[model samples]
Target: MTSDGDDTTVLSTEEGWQTIQATIHDARGAMYTAGSTAILLMWAGIISIAYLAQYAISTFASDFAEQYPWFPGPLWAALTLPGVIGSMTIGHRAGRSLSTGAAMQSVGIRVFLYWMAVVTAAGLLPGAAGLWNETRAETIPYVLVGVIALGHVLFGILHRPVIAVFGLGYAVSFYVPHYIFEGIAPAVSGIAMLALLAATFVWVHRTGEW
Candidate 1:
């Protein structure tokens, strides 16, 4: 009877440890989700605004574009800088709330490096192959959107299905507009992305999955 009791106590202790670990895992996931969701929403707004602005400039400010052919590059850099800073801030705050904050931050840094590598490859490979030029400048937006969509899809496949759906929505938004309403593709894609992101925000809150 004493041996059986000892065995039961050991089993209970193991179960308790397992439960504690699961709770910690869930908490980490929730924190990461909260940080990531905010980052995604912020980027969605920034990117959509950039797209809309591009459309407006190209359509209503032809003189400006002609006078300053380099304006778009500067504009994008200006707009993107804030998002980058904001993302880092959000991630840092989220990390601080976790017990393993340093480790979590390290992981985040590694993930960021992975994305940088992906973006670098995307740019370098095309440039090296002489696939990008002034003649195909208009395709730059499509390529950027494609890269973002692909990243989202891969992220979803590795982490969550919902993200993959967002990726699909982004692809469809741009592609459908490109083929069917080429003149307004930028506007349509921007609006679609904003709408999709808004819906995702609502869904996450309602489901409490994040």
Candidate 2:
């Protein structure tokens, strides 16, 4: 006893739900794409800055250590400051562009804050020790590797298994450079970390999975 109008209404309702579902699917994909692209670009920028700074130091500051022993500290700050700012800006814009769930974004923000706190504590420990003693600066890079590895593990907990596996691999691979290049362990560790991050970013870009 159903009329034609009732059949038409049912079809329209089904079509509406399908459209909504499709839109949600597309939005999720967009969010993922944006995140991957942002991380890729941000890490690439950091890598470029590191290499470029090394070039500048070697070319222009060959005798800097003799005259100004504190030169490397400022140089490192110069190199890191931009990378940090640029990465945050890139991530913010990418996340803003896609209409993702607010609850999910809040969770991500909280996790990121926790990661930052952990890393900050790691960095501050060496800094405090350095203030107390003279030779502690040399340990900063090695400590950073540990901190970064921990952050990646945190990401795996909050995000996925792949990052956790990468974290484990990185933690293991990090010690090689420290032991091999004792005099320049920090620089070597930085370069090695940049390479690993670049490789990870490339894989993410190619697969579109994080």
Best by lDDT: 1
Per-candidate TM equals 0.77, 0.61
TM-score of predicted structure 1: 0.77
Could you tell me which residue pairs clash in candidate 1?
none
Question: Model 1 residue 27 lDDT?
Answer: 64
Q: lDDT (CA) for every model shown?
A: 0.67, 0.57
lDDT of 2 by residue, 1-210 (tens): 346657533446777899999998776544544443344335334533554464456546868644654554576567666655654555555566554667434433443344446546655766775732323433454565577667667656554666677677667666776678765654565566667767877887798673
Tens digits of per-residue lDDT for model 1, 1-210: 236536543446777899999998876555445455555556657766877787788789989977776566667668877876776676666555554657766555444444445444544554565545545545566666677678767866765677778778877876787677767777877888888888988997898644
Determine which window of 10 residues in candidate 1 has minimal summed lDDT. Answer: 1-10
Candidate 1, superposed: residue stretches over 4 Å from native: 1-34, 111-134
Residue 205 in model 2: lDDT: 73
TM-score of 2: 0.61
Candidate 2's C-alpha runs over 4 A off are 1-62, 100-115, 131-134, 180-191
Q: Could you tell me which 10 consecutive residues in candidate 2 have the lowest summed lDDT?
A: 131-140
